[model samples]
Target: MSKITVLVVDDHPLLREGLIKILSLDDDLEVVGEAGDGETGIKLVHECRPQVVLMDINLPKINGIQACKVIKEQYPETQVIVLTVYEEEKLVLDIVRAGANGYLLKDVEPNTLVQAIKDAVCGKAPLHPKIAGKVLHQFGQMAKALDMNNGPLLTNREQEIVRLMAKGATNRSIAKELFISEKTVKNHITNIFKKLEVGDRTEAVIKAMEKKII
Candidate 1:
């Protein structure tokens, strides 16, 4: 089998080297490049076309969130896994919105980090337990708020779509997960927007949280 090419982007030289060393031990993975900042990371991504990127959120120049956004926009096929020490809810949400495939804390077990890279390549989102818990807690709070507010009741399917949207899943990913066509996902989103009195996905998510529709 072919190796999964990877790029390591972090500001710390020691951490970057350590990651490369760890990933190198996995026969199925190859560290093809490294960058110390977000700008260079993007440049290396374009140059190397790695299948996976291990990115640090607090990088110099553009910062990892912006780099992830640009990389995903320019090369949707490339998967980015954020490796950082931050466990803040807002940062987690921002990284997801920027199209990161996974979020792992800096202290993650070596084996778990390796597996996260593999999972990302398989189109699976791997979020740190703390980060995932925060997202789930937020969702749960929204559900409870919806109950208390007596907001417009959404169908089970619509609620599912809204939940997925809040998790930052693309329409394509949502369709695949729901076993429906992309067109169907779009239609559902349209109905959801109308019901929630929102415009786009971001606005819909905000409104859903504010109104507790999801």
Candidate 2:
């Protein structure tokens, strides 16, 4: 079996070294490289081509989310698992939108962290239970709004557009994924905006979530 190669990225020297030490104990995992900041992390990830990247959100040069975006954009095969002290829902949502596969807090046990890495490598998202609960509550609020109407609404295409837009995907990316022309996408977006009574993508997504359209 091929061992999983991982790149550790943290602004703190001790944290980076500590994560490497923790991950090194796993027979199936290898710490291929380390970076003290996000820019260097991005460079290392590109150079190492690791299967999994354990990254910290608070970095020096750039934020982890931006680095994840760059790395995932250039190397879609690489999986990033955010390791940080933050438990903010918005940050979690942002990182996920940026293409991170998992989110693990720094307080997580070494064994659990190792398991998260393994899960991420296999394309599974692992979130702390508390974090997951918070996410569920967020979804539940949306669900409640969606069920508020007498009957279900929103066509499948509108739903798709909202989901992509909510995740901060570019119109071009959405068009490619939906296999629609850019003009067609713009047309659909306009229609979606009109139906949602929203003027822009951000507002549209907010409205869609409130209606459980996504």
Candidate 3:
């Protein structure tokens, strides 16, 4: 079996070392590289071509959000998971918009962290429970403030898919739950994005909430 390659990117040396140690314990995970800031992290990512990256949002140069955007734009195959202390709704939304595959708080347990990395590599959006709750709450508030009657109405299937997406379900899991193929799920999601006028799952959920479609 092949191991998942990971790049640890955080400004704190001790935290970086600790994360590397924790990730190294899992036989299926390999810590291929480390970087102290977002800039170097991007550089290492290009060099090492790791499948997954554990990134800190608060970096000295070109914060994680920017780095994530660049990485995704340049190498969409590489998945990024934001590992940060901040759970602010704005930061979470920003990271999501920047194309991070997952968001985990710094206080996450070692086991959960490892699972998150694995999940990200499998195309799952592993958002911390607290962060996910906050995002949902924010979206709900925005929805309440908007006029729901004005936007495009989603079909029952699309609405269901968006609800699962809000809960951080991956395409595979969504397919399993809905009793459909992953390809069908992808097709539905593409339609959902078009109707919602959003680019990704996070934005789709936000838009769905804003339009009260889910």
Candidate 4:
């Protein structure tokens, strides 16, 4: 059988080297390329066309989430498994939306990580247990909130954002109204999405209004 082609993308030189070293010990796995940033990772993806990509979230130029999105868009068959230290709920959802095949933490055991990469090539998600818990719990909360017709219990600031959203206000407009940065507005909206279990601003607004939370 041909070795499973892989690419390692991370901002830290040490981490990238370390992952390469681990993969090197596996006879069936091949490290085709390594990149220190997401931009280089994307470039190398095209050049190497690896079967699996081990991606990190923090990087200069383009972030791993955006890079994963681009890569999956262009090469839907390519498997990108996010390997990061972040356990943030929103980051998990973001990467999931970007079409990551798996989510593994930095502290994963070497054997487990290796097996995860192998699983990715076979079209399976070998999500870290903690990561899987968070993803499932999030959806569970959303489902329960929806079933109970109670909504996700938005914060005061999040309610303000949703009310503005009902008026079709843009993120910039909401930020200006709240005197917070645009990124803050976006984050608040993300929370709103989680609470309400809605996908976009329109859906969020409708849910909030129907529940009389706005």
Candidate 5:
């Protein structure tokens, strides 16, 4: 099996070293490169083209949010996980807006970070538990009078899947809850996004609320 290639980016030398060490313990993960600043991180991303990037919020040059945006725009397939200590709601929102695949704290357990990388590569948005609540809260505040004049309607199953999605449930969790396979859950979410005309889980939630579909 091919191991997941990762790039560690942070200003702190000790932290970057620690993260690389943790990644080394995982048989399925490989650290392809490391950087001490966001500019170098971005350059390394171009050079190494790792599968996932562990980005820190406070970088010397570009900063995590902007770097993440650059990566997503330039290489959407390369997942970026913001590994930061800042958990402020606004920072979470900013990182999410910049298209981070996951938001995890520096204090996260090594095993959890490893699992988060795997989950992220699998297309799951693995937010820290606290950050998850902020995203959910943002969705909660998004209800509006929907102009459904051209909006497509979702089937009952799609509604169920999306509702779970709004609750920040993973594909695995949604499948287990609905007694379906993960592939089936993914299919449902794909259909939901298509019907809702949204790009991601966050947009789907907001669109669902706008239509009062959930």
Candidate 6:
């Protein structure tokens, strides 16, 4: 496979420089460019056409979430991994909704950061363990908040699915535990998304919790 091209975006010069240095040690990866702000990052991304972008959430001109949305919209093939200090569920959820493929806390080990970059390049939703709980709780809260009228009016079976989803169960596991087919699970998810007005599982769970439907 070709080397993965990466772009670093952060307002802090030291952080960007450190990341570049860390990534430089990886022979399989290449740092294509760097930017000091979100807008500049977006422009560099378009110009550099990097396969992956290590983006910081706090930036000068535009916020990282907005930058992620712009980059993802214009370059669907480019994957973004948020490298931030924020561990709040709301922030993580917002970033994911904006199209980030992965999230890593700022204090992550060098090796882990390298692994996360590789994972993001390979289409995996890599998340720091410390932040994973927050993400999962966000999903649970979403499942708990749903009410019948506004959220997806889940059937008893679908409700079961939502419950497992809130607990962070994958579709295959849900299928195995519930004795249902994966296709059936997917169909339910589609209906769930339509009913809840959500595009992804995390959002669906959040909406469900908001309405107390699940």
lDDT of each: 0.86, 0.80, 0.89, 0.83, 0.85, 0.84
* Native-referenced Cα lDDT, model 3: 0.89
Candidate 3 vs candidate 6: the TM-score winner is: 3
The reply for model 3, stretches above 4 Å from the true place, is none
Per-residue lDDT of model 6, residues 69-178, tens digit only = 99988987788999999988888989988978788999999999888888666545678887788876776666555544764467888888888876657678889999
TM per prediction: 0.71, 0.68, 0.89, 0.68, 0.80, 0.73
Model 2 / residue 76 / CA error / Å: 1.5
lDDT of 6: 0.84
Question: Ten consecutive residues with minimal summed lDDT in candidate 2?
Answer: 145-154
Q: What is the Å distance of residue 100 in model 1 from its true position? A: 0.8
Question: Which 10-residue window of candidate 4 scores lowest in summed lDDT?
Answer: 142-151
The regions of model 4 sitting more than 4 angstroms off are 145-214
Best by TM-score: 3
lDDT of 1 by residue, 25-133 (tens): 9999999999999999999999999999999999999999999999988998899999999988888878877878788999899999999899777656788888889
Candidate 3 lDDT tens digits, 1-214: 9999999999999999999999999999999999998899999999999999999999988899999999988988888999999988999988888888889999999999999988877767898999989877887788788886978998999889988987778899999999999999999999999988877776687677778888
Per-residue lDDT for 1-214 in model 4, tens only?
9999999999998888999999999999999999999999999999999999999998899999999989988887788999999999999988887778788999999999999888777645678889878876766565555644465577888888887765546677778998999999988878888888865554565566556575
Worst 10 residues of 6 by lDDT: 143-152
The C-alpha stretches of model 6 lying farther than 4 A from their native spots are 148-214
TM-score (C-alpha) between model 6 and the true structure? 0.73
Clash total of candidate 2: 0
Winning candidate number (lDDT): 3
